[model samples]
Target: MYYDLMQTGLVGELLITGDNDGLKKVCLIKGKNDFIIPSDWIRDEVLFSDVKEQLGQYFKGNLKEFDIRLTPEGTCFQKLVWDALTEIPLGTTVTYADIAKMIGRPKAERAVGGAIGANPILIIIPCHRVIGSSGKLTGFSSGLENKVLLLEHEGMEIKGSERSALVM
Candidate 1:
């Protein structure tokens, strides 16, 4: 396994941990915080250059979509939720209840949110696109500010803590 940490201009630090087979996790690094890199993990810029480039482009609003291979570890339901997240088009948002219905568990909105929170891959998995049923920006593992920034970066219309929606 290997890992590389990348810091974007707006999104801050990102910890990308993975193996040769595929990516395992990509987490946002909070302020001034440090993480223990495994002894076996070697820092390789080349290994994650594409992700860095894509994320950079995304932050700049030059890229609306991502084309990267990811292998996030989670339970079957979580995997299903994560996969469904990818189907959410750029510049659009969906509610947790919507995801629950998509997965044939309309009564499992809270469970869907739980799965969303467990998503190891952030922007690549599009978990930020999920919002509250009332159209308000909800909890984001990466933080509300970052989530708002990301939604703005994607051209999604966001109002002052009161509403969240796509422009088109």
Candidate 2:
């Protein structure tokens, strides 16, 4: 089943997916307010007895790492991108091209963007770390403002405060 762990700042969401076998995926998101169950936002079974309690702890700025297991279902490249995101240290950021290079696709920046947008899991995957070549924050299904806020919260520096605006 899939479940969510909302961050304390109300600016991030973590999608946790798992099954009878065990946990599988953990996606982190920023500036996303939607938590509906009917849509694709969530498809796995979710009914954790302590979900609300745990979420409260998260919202209170008391929790760091999550305790839920998620099974993110996606393609190999997509998974690779997501995995790379996890490697990004907390309070740090990386560019989409950096992710492509990490995956041995230095020229597949566009492809990396596509995978990032398709990331259903959000915050846990840390797609917010990917930015424009000019070092400006960019595309995010959850909204760019939220993305910026997430970076700020993590203490990650954002360059080009003016010139480099979001294009995607």
Error of 2 at 20 (Å): 3.3
Best model number under TM-score: 1
Candidate 1 lDDT by residue in tens digits, 1-168: 778888877778899877776788888888654567768779888888888899888877788778888888899999999989989988899999899988899999989999999999988899999988777888888888888888887887776653343223
Give, for candidate 1, the lowest lDDT window spanning 10 residues.
159-168
| lDDT string, candidate 2, 23-48, tens digits | 55444543344543435454533554
Q: What local distance difference test score does each model get?
A: 0.84, 0.64
Report how far off residue 37 is in candidate 2 (Å).
Answer: 2.7
Native-to-model Cα distance after best TM-score fit, residue 155 in candidate 2, in Å:
1.0
